[model samples]
Target: MPNPSSAVSRRTLVTAIGATAAAIATAPAAHAAAPSTTAAPSTPAPAAPGTQAARTVTVPATRARSAAGRAAAGVRTDFPIQYVGVSWDGPRRGGAIRLHHEETGPGSWQPIATGCAGGPDVAGTAAKAAPVSAALVPAGGAVGYDLRLPDGATNLRSTALDTTTGPARTTTLSPTTPVTFCGVEYLSRAAWGADESKRFKNGVENSPAKYYPLQTLTVHHTDTPNADPDPAATVRAIYEYHAITNDWGDIGYHFLIDEAGRIYEGRWSGDDGIPGHDANGNAVTAFHTAGFNSGNLGVALLGTLVNQEPTAKARRSLALVLALAARTHGLDPQAHVTFVNPVNGVTKPVDLISGHRDWLATDCPGGIMYGTLPALRAEVAAL
Candidate 1:
């Protein structure tokens, strides 16, 4: 005779086991069975081959459900979904990497690997074929890596990651001008500031000042040559002349460059670097320019070039100075500004580079050198 209680218990056990087996077979590999706390019948049942059975017979159903939710949300795997690699395929070396994304959340990407050659270790080892790993990037973001050259300098290279599929962008950098050739320390505004107050000539001084967000750079040429012939003496003489003859607090121009292409500082204002003084009994502005004195930077060369042609060294120095001035002022080199000839009333689309004659009544920068202004600007643009 079959016991009635035993028969009921057997039926319940069979139903539960069938349901669990079906779930295990159909669910994804990421999902695994969770333990349950409810008591089972006296005779425990066996599951299919390769299936893991619940070890502890006391897990809450709520906990199992929470774990399943996390697994479906991709929380079970710690490995990154994307990877990055760097390589130098000849002409396609340094550039920035742009990452595009389909979603709009806070996302970022990082380098998991790098392909670089010999140099000092940075972020890690700096040898050829050495792999470097970076911290994980947030979703929808990018990172940049500067590859080291054999000479132990860095070049631009970038990588980006996107959780969603999107196109990548790259920006190549042009060769940089050597800091020494540019006449001032590269990227050091403070260094340039401290060097301005020294005298270049008996009466002239080079006083450095901050730029005041002005858009125009007024160019000029010093008409006299001191017997000293030394660049520092030339700058000193100009400062003294301006202070004594012109009765100004400092030099008129913001910068002065000697024929050797060395930059000297002139004038001082707060960090804006443009020359300005008090008004009232200070009623008159500094004599840097006549009409545009309020919003222009005056830069004077050390010697007269009206009759002589500017040398290659002088031209390069001027271009660098102009480029630096334009960048500091946030002026666009490519954007053309209108220059209406004060005498003829004819207007020309002048490049951001301008002459002293444009603002004041002087043959500043002279006829011979001024003719080459267009070419000079083109050279700087290439840089």
Candidate 2:
């Protein structure tokens, strides 16, 4: 069956119905990037050649039992690591995975969190390939992990990630100035060292970029450790996890905001200068929301917000981005709207600025951050 999202023209869709989009491509692939103006999007382009993987290490779980008579595994990594996740070969099931960290082998252990699982919405089943459910979590730049796996699990695989290599890669402890466009300032893909070649495998893109009219703007948290050493590198690791590890061929969120209030571009919208919008001010469909990805825009906070709150800088940036999106898309940040999915016609009642958990049965965008929606909405509305 032909995809209704890709079959329609951007201009025609906007005129017929004012719907925004989250990306869901149907074709093999094309290149992407948007223009500086709120209106400019050339067709997608073919990406550059592939670069060999480096930094990401796949560690096999060594099954063990602790004194508590619970199933667990111990991974003593020798390299500098930042993120961790576990995967199984079979279908995803209900269970919990707890991770602790140590800076050295057999040193000391501290608890991190259980099932910090995050990424593109698993509920949306329209992608060309299935994404391996890696209950991904931030490793706090630790050298080892204490793992507690779910009972009766099979084909277990654990992977550790480290994007900061050495002196060669910039370990930017400070935020850089973001490029301004669409009434906001943000880091472009090139600014953050995005390897666009990853969009393709051999020669064909996994899923081409898709565009739709503006709908709603959503918020989320990366579930990564706060006070990030190199937020840019964290963004790259997430791109790798989502594009390659999850097999989505792109990052999930439309924008990622660091603790310092620097906003990095997420998902390849186009090369036309606009971040998430097409030449006509239409939005690019992203992987943030599952069945309702077509017109919802997703912006994520960089660190874990479960127990803590976002820095004032990050909150300011979030409000700025949301306000601009709401103004541009003709949305009331404080009002409720029933969103209709453009492709599948799924209907969802949502706030103009909602938490990630609003769309699916997941604790995303964190609990504390989700609770401040009313204030966030008022701030955006005021802006």
Candidate with the greatest lDDT versus the true structure: 2
Worst 10 residues of 1 by lDDT: 58-67
lDDT of 1 by residue, 286-341 (tens): 34653344334566666666778655555666666666545433456555675432
Against the true structure, candidate 2 reaches a TM-score of 0.70
Per-residue accuracy of model 2 over 1-383 as CA lDDT, tens digit each: 11233333445434322222221112111121221211222223343566322121111111111121122255556665566655543435544434444523343433434322333332334422122334566666566665544446465555666655432321111122345442245677765656677678878986578777767788888887788866777787777667665567898889988887777889898877677777666688878766667778999998889888899878877887786677555668898888767766667788868887887655778899999989999977775
| Maximum-TM-score candidate | 2
**lDDT at 366, model 2:** 89
Q: What are the clash counts of all predictions, listed in order?
A: 39, 32
lDDT per prediction?
Answer: 0.37, 0.62
| lDDT agreement of model 2 with the native | 0.62
Q: Model 2 off-target regions past 4 Å?
A: 1-78, 88-103, 107-133, 140-148, 154-157, 166-177
